[model samples]
Target chain A: MKIIACYSNKGGVGKTASSANLAHLMAQSGHKVLLCDLDPQGASSFYFRLKPAKKLSEDSFFTDQDKLLKAIKGSDYENLDVLPANMDFRDFDIFLSRLAKGHSALKKALKGVKKDYDIVLLDCPPTISMLSESVFSCANWVLVPVIPSTLSERTLEQLLDFFTQHKLEKSKILAFFSMVQVSKKLHLDTMQRLGEQHADLLLNTYIPFSSHIERMGVNRAPATDFAKATPAAQHYLDLWRELATRI
Target chain B: MPRLWHSQGEGDFTPLLSWLENKAVQRGLVLSQTEFLSGPLALIDNGDCQIAEQGKSLLRLSHKLLSISQRDIYPLHRKDQPPFDFPLPPRELCERIEQPPAWLLGLAPLRNLQILARGKGRYQQWRLTNRLHKTCGIIYLLDIELNGISAQHFCFCQTYRGFTKSEKLLTSWQRYIKDVFPGQTAGVSEIVALYRRHPLVVHHANTSMQKGRPDIASQTKRWLKPLLLAAFSNEQGIILDIDTEYLHQYRVNMRKARSLLSLCKGAFEENQQQHCANQLANWMQNTNVLRDLDVHLQDQVTYQQILPPHLHCQADKLRHNLQKERQIAQQRLSDQLQSTAYQTNKQILMQSIAQLNDGDKGQKPATQYGRKRLIRQLNKIFVLTGQLHDQSPDDELHRLRIALKKARYLAEFFQRPKTTKRLSVLASSLKQLTQDFGLFNDACVQQQALHGWLDSARAIKRPPSENIEALTLLLRYYQEQKRQTKYKISQHLRLLNDPNHQSALLAATQNLI
Candidate 1:
C-alpha cells in the first residue's frame, strides 16, 4: 500500500480538494482508497459530509489501534472510505512530543489499515510544522499542490529546502501545478519558469482553475462525482491518471 | 447494509407512512416524497440455476432494465430474447459474476405475478447523533413493493465519520425495526429464492434404482418413467430451438433409459424389449446429426485458436455452412418428433413400461439379476480394456471406451442399497477413466466431423481454399489433442487397471448376488 500526502505549505492551493478528488477517482478505478483527513479544520471530511467522532481524541489517534479502526467510515461510494479528522487533532504535534519515536508514530498508526487500503491519501494541514515533519517521514509521496504563482513557487522551494536540510529524499516531493488560470500573464510566466526549473519534479498535467471546483462545497461531494463532465473534474481525472502511473 | 425483511400482514400503507413520518419528525429529519411507481419484474436464472447457485439474483424490471443491484442496472430492451443473446449492461457486475452474458441459459419469461411496486422517492435520511447532537452517520432506507403492497424493505447505513458510529447506529436501527415489525426479517438470498421461479426441466434428478426394492420390473419402470418424461418434456423446448441443452439433455435421458432396458435383459418380453430398444435408437439417431453439429459449432473458439488469423474468413464460411446444415437438421428432428410414428412409439413405450407386470417371476431375484448383468458388463469391459495397448487401433480404443461407458451406466442403474464406500470409490474411478477415454474418442470424432465437412463441401459450389485450409488446421489441432489425450489415457489406466480396483469392483458386484 502507498501513502500519499496531498500537502502544501501554502493554504488555498487545492491541497484538500486534490486529496478528496483523487481518493474518489482512485476508488472508482477499483482501488480501495482511504482518505485520511489529518487537517484540524477537516475541510476534506466536510467535503465528504463526514463529521469526526469525538471519541477519537489526539491521544487515541496514534496509540489505540481499535480507536483508529473505528474512526474509518465507509463513504457513500463503493471502495472509498474516510478517516475523518477530530477537532482535538489540533494538539497532534503536542501529543507527538510526548511519544517516543514520534517521527514514525504516524506511519505505525497507519500500518493498521495498510492491508485494507490500496492507497491512503492524507489531506494534510498547511504549515511546515512538527506534523509536516512526521508526514515527510511517513508518506511514500508528498504531493504538493502549487497554485502557479510566485508565492506558491517560493513555498515549494521552501518545502524542498526543508527536505534537503533534513536529509530526506527530495524525490518524494511531487510538486504539481494547481488552480491554473491560463488567461493570467503572471500565472503563465511562473508556470513556465517552474516547469523548466523543476522539469522532473512537476507532474505533466495541470489542474485549471474552475468554478465547478468551488461548488464542491455546495455539492458536498467530489467534483468527479457531481460535475463529472466539467473541465475541473477532467483535470483531476488526468492528474489521478498521471499519479496512478507513477505509483 | 442490513438484511431486508418481507412484511406480510398489512393495512393501508397510510398508517405505516405516518408512523415513519412521525418518527422522522421526532428526529427532526425531512422525509422526501414522490409519486408511486409500479412495474412488472421477473427474477431469472440459468438452466442450471447458476445465478441462484452463486447466491446472486438478476431481476428484469418492466422488460426495460435488468438489475443485479441498486447501482448495477442494465437496460435490456429485447425482453423476448434470451439473457445470453442481448448485451447486458453494468459490465463491471458481469465481470464480477465471472460468467459472460451470452452463455446465461434459460432466461425465464416475465410472469405477471412477478411485478414489483417501487417507491419513486427514497425514505427520509437519518442522522446518527451523539449526546451532543453531532452528526455521526447517516441511514437510508429503500422499500420494494409487490402487487401494490409494500412487501419488502432494505435499509443501508454508513457512518459519516467512523465504523463505530455506523455499528452503533445499525444496532440501534435493528432494535427500532424489531420494535416496529415483530419478526419478519429475511435475507436477500432467501427473498430471491422464494420469488424466483426455477426452470422445470432441471439437469439433476433422482434416477437411482435401489437393490432391494421388491420387484425389479416395477422398480425399473419407476426409474425409466421419469427419464422418458424428462426426455419428452425437453422435446418441445428443443423443437422451438430454445436452447441446445434441451436437446443435449433429451439425448441423455433417452440413452439412460436405453441402457437400463439393455441391462435388464429378460425383465420384459423379448419382443417388447427389442422394440423399445430399437425405438429409442431411432429417436437418438434422428437428432444425432444435429447434436453433433451443435457440439462442433460450440467449439468456435477452439477453431479460431487452431487456425491462423488469415484463415478466419474461411473459418467463418465453414461455420456458416455448419449452421445452415444445423437448421436443416433441427427442422428434420422437429418434424420427426411431431410425426405420428414418433408420437405412437413414445406413447407405446411409456404405456408398456408403465403397465409391465411384476408377476412375471424370472429365475433370479432382482439382486441376482442385477449382479449377473453387472458382472457380465464388467467382465466385458475389463477384457476389452485389457486388450488396449499403445499400438492398438483407434477403433479398438473407441470400442473399449464405449464398453466402459455401458458398464458404468449399468452399474449406476443397478446401484445397490447401502453400497460401501469402497464400491463408490471404485465407481468414481471408473467414471473418471471413462471420461478420459471419452475425451480421446471425441478428439477422433471431431477430426472425422471436420474431414466429413470438408468432403461434403466439395459437392457444393467450389468452396474457398481458405476454408479448406482452416479445416485442415482444425483437423491437425484435433490430431495433436488426440495424441495428448493418449498420454492422459495412460495416466488414467493406472487407476482403472489397478489390481485393487479390479478386486474392489468384483467384490462390490459379487456381494449383491
Candidate 2:
C-alpha cells in the first residue's frame, strides 16, 4: 500500500480539492482508496457528504486500530471510503508532541489497514507542526499543490528547504501547479520559473482553474464524477494517471 | 443487502415500477430507468443435466461460457466452441463442475438440443437516487425466456452500501413483493426445469421398471425399448460425424441390447430372440471399423509418445493416413444410416420388439427369471475363474471378460430398490474385473491393428522407412503394455481366488436371488 499526503504548509492552494478529486479518480480507475480527512475543517469529508466520526478522537486515532477502522465510512462511490475528522483532530499536533517516537505513530496506526486499501490518501491541514512532521516521516510521497503565484512558490521553496534541513527524502516531494489560471502572465511566468528550477520534483500536468471544481461544494461529490467532461476533471484524471505511473 | 423474488404468473413489471415510483416520491428521491437486451444464448448440457444438477446454468454466447447461478453470472473465457464430447473443461471451469473426470469425459450434448434459442430475454434497471444523483438503491426486473416459453420475471433489489434510507425502502419493497408475488425465489434450478420441459430437448426414455413382481416379457420390453431408442437417437449424430462419442455410444447401446436378449433368453420366443440378436450384431459390425479408427485417432498422441523424437514426422504421416481411413469409414457408415434399407430394418426391428409375445418362461415372475439367470451367469464365471492361469491365452481372457460383462448387465437389469446395495457391489466388482481384462485386450488389438496397417501400407505403396520404424516402435510399446496389463490381471485373479472374496461374491449374488 502507498501513502500520499496531500499537504501544503501554505493554505488555500487547492490542497483539499486536489486530494478529493485525485482520490475519486484513483478509485474510478479500480484502486481501493481511503481518503483520510486529517484537517479539522473536514472539507474532504463534507465533500463526500459524510459526517464527522465522533467516536474517533485524536488520542484513539493512533493507538486504537479497531476504533480507527470502524470510523471509516463508505462513500457514495464504489471503492472509495472516507475517514472523517472531527474538531478533536485539531489537537493532533499537541497529542503527538507528548508521545515518544511520534514521528512513526501515524505509520503504525496505518499498518492495520495495509491489506484493506491500495492507497491511503491523507488530506492534510495546511500547517507546519508535529502532525506534519509525522506525515513527512511516514508518507511515500508528499504531494504539494501549489497555486501559480509568488507566495505559493515561496512556500514550496520553504517546504523543500525544510525537507533538506531535516534530512528527509527530498525526492518524496512531488509538487504540481493546481488552480492554474493560464490567462495571467504572472501565473505563467511563475510556473515556467518553477518548472526550470525544480525539474525533477514538479509534474508536467497541471489542474486548470474552472467553475466546475468550485461546484464540488454544491454537489457534495467529487468534481471528476459530476463534471466529468470539464477540463478541471480531465486534468485531475491526467494527473492521476501520471502519478499512478510514478507511484 | 440484496433480495431476489420471482413472480408466480406471467410477470408484469408495471405494478412493481409503480410501487417503486410511489416509494421514491414519499422518500423524496429521484427515480430513473434503464433497459437492456441480451443477444441469443444457447443452453448446453448432457443427457443427465450434470451442469444443472450442481445448480448452475451453462450457456454459450458467441465464444464465451457463462455460468449463471442464483446469485451471480461468471463468464468464463473460452476461445473455441467445445465439441459434443469435450475432453476436459478449461482450467477455470473445472472447479465449477463437481463431477469426476471420467463422467465429464463421457459428456455429450443432449440429442436435438445442440443449439437452443433462449436469447429473447430483457431486463430493466430501476435506480432510486437522491438530489446529488447518488444511486441509493437499484431494482432489476428480468424477463427470461427459454425457446419461446416465457419464464417468471425475477426482481432483484439491492441497497447501496452506507445508504440506510434505501434499506428502509428495500424492507418495505420486500414486504410488498412477498405479499404480491408470494412463494417464488427464482433460481437456476427453475430455469433448468424449464429446459427439461422444452419439446425440442430429447429426454432419456423412462427405462426403470416396477420394483416387485414384474412379468418377464413386459420388463424385458421396458428395458429393450429405451436401449433401442437411445441407439437410434445417435444415428443422426453419427451421420453428421459430430464426434467420436456418438459412434462409441451407438455401439455400446447396441451391445447392451444384444447382451440383454441373450441373457434373458427365455423371456422371448427363440426365433424372435435370434432375429433381434442378428440385427444388433449387423449394426455393430457396420460401425466396427469406424469405431476402431476413431480410437486410433484418439490415441495418436500416445502413439507419438511411444516413438523417438526423430519419428514424430513419420507419426504425423501415420496420423494423416489414419484420418483418411477414418473419413472413408465414417462416410460408409453415414451412407448406411441414411440408406432406405437401414430405415426399413430399424422399423422392422422396432415393430418386432413391440409385437413380441410371451414365451413359456415369459409368464413367470421377473425376479424369479432374473435370479435364475444371475445364478447361472455367476456359476459360469466361477467355472471360468477356476480355469484361469498366468498362461491363459488372450482368447480365454476375452471369454472370461465377456462372461463378467454379461453378469454385470444381468445384475443391472434385475436391480431393485430393496436389493441395490448387494447388487451394486457385485456389479462394481464385475466392472473392475472386466476393465482390467479390457485393458489387456485393447493393447493386444491395437498392436495387431498397427501391424496390419503397416503391412497394407507397404502393399499399396512402399512407405517411408521412418514410417515403418515408427509403426514398429508403437507396436512394441503396445506389446509391452499388453504384457503389463496381463500381469495386473493375473494379480487381480489371484485376489479373486481368495476364499473370503469368493464367498462374499457368492453371498451377494445369492441374497439377490
Candidate 3:
C-alpha cells in the first residue's frame, strides 16, 4: 500500500479537495482507498458526508489500535472509506511531540490499516510542525497543490529546502497547480515560470478554479460524486489518471 | 447471486418496506429506494447443479448478457464481442459448471428490488450484527418469478464489502428472523430446487446415487432405472451435439447398467434378464463405432504429444480424418436413436423391468444374497489375480481386470453403514488397480488401432510416410507405456493379495452375514 499526503504549508490551495477527489477516483477505478482526515478541519470527511468518528480523540487514535480501525467509516462510494477528523485532532502535534521518536508517530499509528487499503490518503493540515514531520515520514508521496501564485511558488521552494535540510527524499514532493485561473496574467506567468524552473517536480495537469468545487460544502460529497460533469471534477480525474501512471 | 427469503404472501412490498422504514426512523437512518427493473433470466448450471452447490451462485443469462455476480458479464447477443469461453474465472463458481450453455436449466421472469440505507451506521451495523450474512451491501430484493404462475421470492443481496464476522450477530439474526417471520423464510437455492423438481423445468434425469443399503432387487432396479433415464435424457443433447459429456455420460450409464446386469445375475426372471441383456448388448454394439471415434477425437492432444514436432501436420491430418469419421458416426447414432426399431426396443425394455418380480424364485433374502455374492466374487477375483504370471498375455490380464471390476461393482451394490469404512478402503485399492489396467489397455488399443489404420490406408492407397511415421511413434509410445506399467500392475496385485487386506475385506463383509 502507498500513503499519499495532500499537504501544503499554505491553506486554501485545494489540498483537502484534491485529496478527496483523488481518493474517490482511485476507489472508482477499483482500488480500495482510505482517506485519513489528518486535517483537524475535517474538510475531507465533510466532502464524504461522514461525521467525525464518535468519541475518537487524538491520543486514543494513535495509542488504541481498535479506535483508529473502528473510526474508519464507509463513504457513499463503494470502495472508498474515511477516518473522519475530530476536534480532538487539533492536539495531534502535541501528542506526537511527546512521543519517543516523535517524527515516526503517524507511521506507527497508520500501521494497523496498512494492509486493509490499497492507498491511504492523508488530508494533512496546513502547517510545518511535529505532525508535518510525522506526515512526511509516513507518506510515500507528498502531493502539494499550488494555487499558481507567487506566494504558493515561494512555499514550494521552502518545502524543497526543508526536505534538503532534513535529508528527506525531495523526489517525494509532487507539486501541481490547483485552483488555477488561466484568465489571470499573474497566475499564468507564475505557472509558466514554475514549469520551467521545476520541470520534474511539477505535474502537467492543473485543477481550474470553479464554483462547482465550492458547492462541495452544499453537496456534502466529493465533486466527483455530486458534480461529476463539472470542470474541477474532470481535472481531478485527469490528475488521478496521470498520478496512476507515475505511482 | 445472494441468498433469498420469501414472505408468506405476495402483491405487496408495503409491510416489509414499512418495517424497514420504521426501523430506520427508530435508529436515525436514511432509507433510499431504487426503481425496480424486471427481465427474463435463464439460470444455467450443470445437470447436477454443480455451480450453485459450490458458490451459491448461478449463471444468469438476462438482457442478452450472461454473467455470474461479481464475475464476467459477456453480451451473448452482441456479434462484435468474442464468444464466451468455458472454465470461467473467479474460481468460486464458474469452474464447477462444465459447458454452461449446454447446461441451461430453467428460464424465469425476474424482478429486481433494491432497498438502500435507512440509518447512519445501519449498513455496517446490520452486517456486524447478522452472523449468517456473507453478502456485502445488503439490498432487499423482491423477485416475482413465473413457476407455472407468478411466485414471489425476497432476496437479501450483498454488494461492496461483505458482512463483518461476528458470531453474536449470526445467532441473533437466526433467532430474530425465526421469531419475526417463522415458516415464511426460504433460501433462494431451496426455492430454485423446488422449481427444478418439475420435469419440464429440469430435463436432466436424477443421476445422483442413492444412499444406504436396500434390498438387492430394489437397489438394482433403483440404480438401473435412473441410469437408463439419464441416458434417455441425454439423447436429445447428444443429437444436438451440444457437448461431448452428454454422449459420454450416456455411454457411461449404459455401460454401468450393463455391468450391473452381468454381475448380479438371477436378480430377475431368467427369460427377462436374458432379453434385457440382449437388448443392452445390441444398443452398446450399435453405439460402439460412435463412442470409439469420440474417444479418438477427444484424445487428439495425447496423440499429438506422442509424435515428433515435424509430424504435427500429420497429426493434424489424422485428427481431421477422425473428426470426419466422428461426424458420420454421430449422424448414424442419431438416426438409430430416432429409429422406430430402437425406440420400440427401449420402450419394451423399460416396460418389461416393471413387470419383473423383485428377486428370482427360490432366491434367498436380498441382504443374504448380496453378502454371499460379494464373498463369492471376492474369492473369484483373488483366485484370478493369483493365477496371473509375469509373462501373462494381454488377454489374460484383461480377463483379470474384468473380474476385479465385477467384484468391485458387487461390493458397491451392497455398501451399508457398517461396511462403509472397509468398502472405502477396498474401493480406493480397486480404483488404483483399474487405473493401472486402464493404462495397460490403452497401450494395447493404440497399437491395434494404428495397425488397423495402416491396413485401411493400404486398401485405399499408399499412405503418406509422415502419417505412417506419426502412427509408428504413437505405437512405440504405447509400447513403452505397456512395458513400464508391467511392474506397477504386479505391485497393485500384491496389495490386493496381501493377507491383511484379505482379512480386512473378509471382516468388513463378514458382519453382513
Candidate 4:
C-alpha cells in the first residue's frame, strides 16, 4: 500500500479539500482508498458527514490495530472509507514523544491497514511537529497544496529547507497550485516565478478557485461528486491522474 | 443481506412506493427512485434442474449471465448468446457450477419457455437517504410478466454495510411489507421453481410399479412409457450434436426399455415384443461407433497422462483423428435420426406399445410376475457363476454380465417401498459385479479398436515410429487393465462360490421377492 500525505504548514491552503477530492477520485478509478483524517479538527471527516470517532485515544491510535480499524467508517461512495479523526489526536505529537520509536510510530500504526487498502490518504494537520516529522518519514509522497501567493511560496521554500536540514528526500515533495484565480495578475506572477524556480517539484495541473468548491460545505460531499461537470472537478481529476503516475 | 418478497398481484408498484415514502418521512429521510435494468429476463437450466437444485438461479439479462443466490448477485458471463456446452461458459460461471466439467457436458436449454414474457418496465431501484444525503438502505423492485397470465413483482431490500442506523428502519419495513403483502416472503430460488413447474420441462418420473397386487399390463405401461418418451425426448439434443451425454442418455433409456421388455415376457404379444426389442437394438447399434468415439475423446486427458511427454504429440494426432471420425459418425447419426424412415419406425413402435394388453401372463399380479422373474434370473446367474473358471472364455463372462444386468433391472422394477434396504443391498452387489465387467469389456474393446487402427495405418501409409510406439503403449495399458479386471471378477466369483454365501444369496432373493 502507498501512503500519500496532503500536508501543508500554512493553513487555508485547501489541503483537506484536496485530500477529500483526491481520495474520492482515486476510489472512482477503482482503487480501494481510505481517507485518514489526521487533523484534530476533523474537517475531512465532516465533509464525508461522518461523526468524529469516539474513544480513540492518542496512545491506542499508534499501538492498537483493532481500535484503529474499528474507527474507520464507510463513506457514501463505493470503495472509499474514512478513518474519522478524534479530538484526542491533538496530543499525537505529545504521545509520540513518549514512545521508544517516535519517528516510526505513525508508519507502524498504518501497517495494520496495509492489506485492506490500496491507498491511505492522510489529511494531516497544518503543523510541523513530531507527528508531521513521522508523516514525512513514512509517506511515499507528500502532496503540498499551495495557494499561488508570495507567502505560500515562502512557506514552500521553508519546507524545502527543513527537508534539507532533516536529510529527508526532497524528491518526495510534490507541490501544486490550488485555489488559483486566472484573473489576478499577482497570482499569475507568483505561480510563474515559483514554477520556474521549482521546475521539478510543481505539478502541471492546478485547482482553480471556484464557488462550486465552496459549496462542498453545504453538500457535505466531495466536489467531484456534487460538481462533476464543473472545471474545478475536472482539474482535480487531472491532478489525481498526474499524481497517480508519480506514485 | 437482501430480503425478498414476491407478490402475485398486478405489476403496479405504487403501493410499495407510497409505503416506502411514508416510512422515509416518518424517519426523516428522503426517498428517491431511479430506473434500473429493464429487459426480458430469461432463466436457463438443463433438464434435471441441477442449477436450481443448488439453491441458485442462472438468469440472462440482455447479454450478461448472472448467477444469483439469496445474498449475492455475480455476473458470470457476458456474451450475446447463452452457452449450452462445456468449456463455452467462462471460468467465472464454471467455477460456480457444481462438478462443472462433467455436469456441464449434459447441459441443454429447456424448451417451451413460453411462460417467460418480454415485458417492459422490468426493474426499478429505490433508496432511502438520511439528512446528510447518505443512502442507508435500498429497495430493488423487479416486475415479472408471465405470458397469458397476470404480472407479478419481486421486491428486495438491502441495507448498506456499516450503516447500523438502518437496521431498525429495515426491520420496520420488513414487518410492514409482510403484513401488507401477506405470504410474500419467498427468495430468489422461488423464481427458478416457478419456471421448473412448466409441463414441457423434461424430468425423470418414478417408474416403480404399483403396490398390492397390481395387474402386470398397467404396471408395465407405467414403467415403459417414461423410458420411451425420455429416450425420444433426447432426439433433438443428439440431432444438434451439442454434447455426448444426449446420445449416452438416449442409449441408456433404450437399453432400459429393452431390458424391461425382455424381463416382462408376457406383457405383450410375442411377435410384437420381439419387434420392439429388435427396433431398440437396431437404434442402439446405429450409435455404437459414435458412442465409442465420444468415450475415447472424453478420455483424452487420461490418455495424455498415461503417456510420457515425448509421446503427447502422437496422442494429439490420435485425438485429432478420433475427433474427425466422431464428426463423421455424429453427422451420420443426426441425419438418420431426422430421417422419415426413423420417424416411421418410431411411430410403429409407439403403436405397438399402445396396442399392448393383458396377454396370457399379463393377467397375473405384477408382484408375482416380478418375483418369479427376479428369482429365475438369480438362479441363472448362480448357474453361470458356478460354470466360471480361471480360464473362462470372454463369451462366458459376457453372458454372466448380461444376466447380472437383467437381474438388477428386475430387482429395480419390483422394488417395494418396504423392501428398500434389501433391494439396495442386492442392487449394490449387482452394480459392483456389472461395473467390473463393464471395465473389462471397455478394455477389450479399446484394445481391439487400437489394433485395427494400427493395422489400417500401416496398410495405408508408413506411420512415424513415435506414433507406433504410443499406440503400442496404449494397447499394452489396456491389456494390463483387462487382466486386472479379470482377476477382480474371479475373486468376486470365488466369494460367491462359498456354500454359506450361496444359500444366503438365495435366501435374500427369496425374502425380497
Candidate 5:
C-alpha cells in the first residue's frame, strides 16, 4: 500500500481538494485505494461524499494491530476505500497513549490490512500536534501541496525539516504545488524555481487554479471527478500516476 | 514422578482395574488396597472406606494402578457437562476411548425428554456407538423451539439429526458397556441409566441443589424446528473442518486453547494448497523481497522505452515492458556453451550465481506475486465483499496488511546467507523494505475507512449528508492517519531506491530455491 498525506501547517491551501482528487485518480487507475480523512474539519470526508462517522465504530479495534484486524468499510468506487474521520478519532491520542506501544498505534492498526488496497491517501489537518506527529510516523510519504507562496514554502520547509533534523527517514516525503495560479508571475516563477532547486523533491504536476474546483464543494463531488476533462483533472491524474508507479 | 501411573504389568491395566471395581460395587462393597499400583494388588490397608468429607460418596483411598480420587471430591466439584470433556466414560458407566458399542448413560426419561425434543429428535443421533467413539456420560441432546418468551427447558436435538428414540439405542448402549468391561453385565431393562456409580451427586445451586432439573415437556417449539431441520442436514456433529488432522500444532500458540481457528489462518480450500503453495505467502510479502521487481517493472513501462506495447496507457506500457525485460533476461541465460575450457573455469562461478538466483535456466522469468492470490484465498475463507467488507477502505487496507505480514514471515524464514559477512548489510535493506511496506499498508487501511463510511450511511438507512456533516469530524481524523501513511510508504520506497540500500536488499532477498 502506498500512503500519500495531503498536509499543510496552514489550512485553506486546498489540502482536502488535493487529497480528494489524488484519491480519485489513484482509484481510477485500478489500484485499490483508501482515502483516510483525518482532519477534524472533515472537509475531505465531505469531498468524498462520506458522512463523517459519529464514532470510530467497531473498527477502532484496528488501532491495536497486535490483535486480529477487525474488518472495515469502503467508498462507492470499486477499489477506492477510505477511513472517514470520526469524533472518536479526536480522542484517538488518549486511546493510543493507553496502548502498550503508543508510537505505533497507527502502524499497528495498519498491520494485516494491505491486501485490500494498492494505495492509501491521508488528508491531514493543518496542525503540528501529536496527531500530525503520529501521521508523519505512520505514512509512507508526506505530500504537501504548497500554494507556491513564501508562507506555504515556510510551512513546507518546517514540515520537511521536522522529519529531516530528527534524522527521520527521508524517502517518504513528496511535496508538490496545489492551487497554483499560473497567471500570476510569482506562481509561475515559484513553480519554476521549485523545480530547479528541488527537482527531485517537487512533483512534476502542479494543481492549477480552477474556478470549478471551488464549486466542487457545491456539487459535492471530488475535483478530480468534477473536472475530469479539465487541466486540474490532469494534475490529479499525474499525481496518481506518479505515486501509483512509485509505490 | 510418573505422569502416567497405570503403565504396569506389560498388558493394559485399565480393564483389570475396571473388573476389580465392578466386583466390589456389585454387592455395594468398597475395595481397599494400598501396597502397590497394579502388580499383585497386595492388600496394604483395609477398611469399610468411609468417604472423606470432601468427596462424601466415593472411597477415600489412593492407588498408583487406578485413576482414583479422594473422598473429599465434592459432588459439586465435578463439573456436570456434556461428557466429552472427561475424555473417558464413567467407570460405573463402562465406556472409554478404546471401547466399542458405547452408550451415553442417558438422563431420566423426563430429563431425556427435556434434552431431546420435537420431530427428528430421535434421528441419526440415536445410532449405536462403538466404545472407541467419544461421548459424554449421561448426556443427550434435545430439539425443541418456542416463541413469545425464552423457554426454560431447551433441547439441542433441533440441531442434531443422529438422535433417535429407537430401541437400537438401548441395545447399542448395552453392547458398549459389555465391550470395554466384560466381567460385569450392566444390568439391562432400564430405559434411561442413572449415573448409578456416583452417590447421586447434588450440588448446592446456591442452596438445595437443583438436581435433575431438565424437563422434556414445557419447552419451546423452536428447538424442535431447528433440531428437526438440523437432523436432516446430516452434518449435525462431525467437525466440518476436516483439514484439522493435517494441521500440526505449533509450539508457539496464541489466541486460545485451540491453536487453529477457522478464522485468520485456516484456508477455505483443502485441495488448493499443493496447487498453489501460499502458507508462507504473507510472510514473504512482509519481507518485501520482490522490491527488485518494482524497478524492473518501472523500467519496462517507462516513457523512454523504445518499443511500447499495443496499449497506449502508461500502466499498460509499464506492464508490457516489465514482461519484455523478463523475457530478455530468460533468453540471455538460455544459450549453453560447448567449450570444456569455459565450462570448467566458469562452472563454479556460474553454479554459485545460479544457486543464488534460482534463475530459470532459459524457461521463464519468475513472476511477481501482486498480493492477489493471497487475497483470493482469504476471500474464500471470508468474503472480501461482504457487508463485513465494509462501504469503505478500512477492510481493504487491513487485508493488505495481512499480506505484508505473510511477506515478513517469509523473509525472516529465508534470511540472507549468514556465511557471508555482507549478510548484515543485506538484512538492513530488508529492514528498510519492511518499513516501506509497513507504510504502504497503513495507507491502505486509512483509505478503506473513508469508503466504508459511505457504505455505513446506506446500511443505517440514512440519506447522505443528513448525518454526514456530523460524521465529518471523525472521517477527517482517519484521513489524517492515511495521509501520514502515504508519506511513510513513499519515503521508505525511495530509501530502497538508494544505491546504498540496493546491494543489501538484493543480498537479503536473493532467491534460494
Candidate 6:
C-alpha cells in the first residue's frame, strides 16, 4: 500500500478536510484508498458516518503479526480496507510500549499487505511524539500541508529540520502550500520563498482560501463532493492529480 | 389448629391430657387433647390422640364437612393465610406421599434424577411441589463426588427435568472434585439434623469415581467458585469437546516445535561450516543451554506428569536425508574440486557420514508418509520394569514391543523382499534412518519411565522404595540386554547402505508401505 501520511507539526493547516477530500478523490478515481484517521478525535469516523469501536481489544490490532492480511476488514468501497484505530489509541501507545515485545510491534503489525492498497493516508495527530515517529516509520511518503502564514512557514522549516536531522530520505517527504489567499501579498511572498528554498520539494498545486472548505465540516460531507465543480473543488482535484503523479 | 399440647408437669402431653379430662366431662361430644391432622373433624367421641390418614378412628365424625381423609379433596390456592396453617399431612402418616404415582418405587412422590452443567461450577436449584415451583424448600442434604452435587438444586433438577434447564452428566473427575463437594462449606457439622429436617436431597448415580466416599480433593468445591459461576448461564453448555485433542495436540505441537528448532539450528551451522568459519558459536551456545535444560526435564519427570516431550523425533530423519543429499549434490558440485572419497579408506567413513546426512530430496509423497508411519510403529516400545508393588497389565506395554520389532524387520536389509523397481530403491532410503532411531528410542523410553519412578519414590511423598528398587533393577537388566542387542542392530544398520542389501530392503519397505 502507498501510505501517504498528511503531517504538519502545527495545527489548523486544514489537515482533516484535506485527508477526507484526498481519500474521497482517490476512491472516486477507482483506486482503493484507506484513509486511516490517526487523529482519533472521531473526526474521520464522523465524516464516514460510522461509530468508533466500542471496545478496544489489544488483540484486535495485535494478533499474528505475520497474518496481517487476514485482520483487515473491507470497507463499503470495493477495494478500500480499514484498520480503524480507537479514540483511546492515545492510551494504547503507553499500553503497547510497556509490553515485553514492543520494539518491532508496529513493524510486525504492518509487515504484510503493503501491495494491497493503492494509497494509505494517515491523518496524523498534530504532534511530534512516539505516535508521530511510529507513523513516519511505517509511511512510504509524508505530505506536509502548510498555511501560508509566517508561523506556518516557521513550522514547515522546523519539520524539515527535524527530518534532516533524523537522516530520512528527502525524496519521501513533500510540502504543499495549502489555504492560499492570493489577496494577501505576504502569503504569495512566503510561497515563492518556500519554492526557492526547497527546489522540486514544493508541490505545484495550492489549495485556495475558500469558505467552501469550511462548509465541508459544517455539512459533514467531503469537500470535493459537497462543493462539486466549484473553484475550491477544482483546486482539490488539481492537487490530487499533482500528488498522484509525484507519488 | 394442628398444635401440640404441652404437658406442663411432665413437659409433655400427660398433664395436659388430665386437664382435658375435666373439660370432657361437661361436653358430651368431648374432643380434648386430640391431635388436629386433617382438621377439627377429629371430634368423634375423641380423646387424646395423634391423628393420621391411617389412624384409628377414636370417634367417627358424622360431620364430614371438615375431615380431610376418605374423599377426593381439591387444592385451594389461599393467599394471605395465617403463617401457621390448620391443615397438614400428619407427621407420621402411613405413606409419605398422599397420592402414589405408579412410577415411584416407594411412597415418596418424587424421584431423584442427575444432570451435569458441563463447565466448571454449579449455578442454582430448589425443590417444591413438581407443579407449583415454590422456593421455601431447605437444603436437606448435600453430597459431593467426582462428578458434581446431589444437592437441593440437583434434587429439584431430578424431580423436574427442566428446573435446572439443560443440565448434562459430568464427564470428568477433575471438574467435579474441583467443584460441588460440600466439606468446603462454612458451617456443615450437623448432618443428621439437616437431613431429618429436609428430605429432598439425593445422590447422582455414577457421579463418584470411588463410590460411597465424598470425593472432596479440590480446595474450591463450592459448587459455584467465584471465577466460573458468573460466566455461565443457567446451564454451562460447551460448544464442543475442546479437551478432546487436548493431550494429543499438545504432544504433537511440542514435538514439531522442537524438530523445527533443531533443524534450523543444524542448517545454520552447516551453512556456516561450508565456509570453514565458526560464526555459529554464539547460536550453538544458546542451543546447547536449551538442550541441556530439556534433557534435565526429561530425566526428572515421567511422560504422564511433565510437559509434552519436545525432544525432536524427526532429528534422525533430517540428519539421514541431509547426509545423503549432500553427497550427490557435493559429487555434482565438487567435480570441479576433483575430490573422491570413493578412492581411499577414508571413503568408508565419509560415505557413512555422507549417507546419514544428505540423501532424499524429491522422493514421492506416499514414500514420505510411509517412512513416517513405519517410524512411529517402530518407536512404540513401551515395556514395563514389572517391579511395582501394584503391577500394571502387560497388554499395552507388550503390544508396543511387538510393534517396534515388526517395524524394524520390515525396514532391515536381509528381511526385505526381492524386486525390480527404481521407486523401491528411493523408498527404503527413509526406512534405514527411522529403524536406526526407532530401535534406540524404544530403549530410552523404558529407561526413563523406570528411572523416573524410582527417583520420585525416594524424594517425593511416594508409597515406598521397595517397588521402585525392584523396578529399577529390572529396568537396568533390560538396558544391558538391549545394549548387547544393539551391536547386532548396528551391523544390520550398516548393511542397509550396501547396494545389494539396500535393493532388497527397498523392495520390502515398498511392500510394507
Per-residue lDDT value at A134 in model 3 = 90
Which residue pairs in candidate 3 have backbone atoms (N, alpha carbon, C) closer than 3 angstroms, thus clashing?
B29-B118, B29-B119, B30-B118, B30-B119, B129-B169, B131-B169, B131-B170, B136-B158, B136-B159
Cα lDDT of model 1 by residue, A1-247, tens digit: 9999988989999998899899999998888889999998988878877776677999898899998887787676667888988789899989997778888999999999988899999999988877888899999999999998888989998998899899998888888899999999999999899999999889999999989899988888999999998999999999999998898
Residue B5 CA error for candidate 5 (Å)? 60
Model 5 whole-model lDDT (C-alpha atoms): 0.42
lDDT of 4 by residue, B211-258 (tens): 768888778888888898888877876776645666877887889899
Which 10 consecutive residues of model 4 chain A have the lowest summed lDDT? A70-79
For each prediction in turn, the share of the native Cα contacts (below 8 Å between chains A and B) that it retains comes to: 0.36, 0.15, 0.00, 0.18, 0.00, 0.00
Error of 4 at B327 (Å): 1.4
Runs of candidate 3 with Cα error greater than 4 angstroms are A1-55, A60-70, A75-82, A96-247, B1-40, B54-80, B83-147, B151-215, B358-363, B485-487
Error of 6 at B419 (Å): 44
Worst 10 residues of 1 chain A by lDDT: A70-79
